[model samples]
Target: MMRLTRRTEYGLMALAWLARAGGRFHSVREITENLDVPRRLLAEILKDLSQAGLVEAVRGPGGGYRLREDPGRLTLGRIVNVLEGPTIFAECYQGDCDLSPRCTIKRGIGEVARRLEAVLEDFTLEEVVHGPAGAPAPSPSS
Candidate 1:
């Protein structure tokens, strides 16, 4: 099964929180305390997102982090790419596979990966915050 690392998961959670907050600058302490994420790790994730241009970091007393773009413009795939590098669906599809030219399984997995990527790309941060009716919002507590 595919799984996102805690870093990516928490990063997305934090972004969703910021989006829900309407792009307000929230400090690391506030985020960690409210979301129950580890402060140090969350800080690193915020730094990475900021460097990727997905988040804007503010300095000084009342400063913190906020989304750089509108939630509707941010895709899940882009966020994943920023936080976790590239999405690799299978180890055998990494180009170093022993059956690189002969494996149908690799091709199939690659196709699935592409489809999944497309779906992820289609999902924006806004969708995550609101979710579908009856579906709970994405939150650290949930």
Candidate 2:
């Protein structure tokens, strides 16, 4: 039952839309209206993205949001980490686990999470918005 949280989904969608604008400032209202997303939620997501240094926010009447970094270099894993923190494939992987001394598969699960992160890091924002053919996503080992 693993799936992306709403915050992550909205963040990605907003980023993809912003990527389409070619770094132009896009207002929250504009994005919400076009994407049919909740205004408050989108605003919060944008704020998180802004704080993450992924997007730049401009103030004043002619202000909005624009991509600060190149989408082609940004990875989904980086965005997820910024919005949702690190990915935990298993609860026992946490260092505070009481059974850490006797636990088995802990390292294996850690490896799973690590490999998953590596796979996600391979995908850039440009590939998310456009086609994967634009740039090759990295493999689990790469």
Best-fitting candidate, scored by lDDT: 1
Off by over 4 Å in 1: 91-96, 99-102, 133-142
Candidate 2's residue-wise lDDT over 1-142, tens digit each?
3588998998898898888766468889888877878899999989988988999999778789999989989998899889888776777776666766788877678777778778889999888987756564332120
Q: How many backbone clashes does every candidate have?
A: 0, 0
- Model 1, 106-131: lDDT tens per residue? 76777787898999999999888888
State TM-scores per candidate. Answer: 0.84, 0.86
Worst 10 residues of 1 by lDDT: 133-142
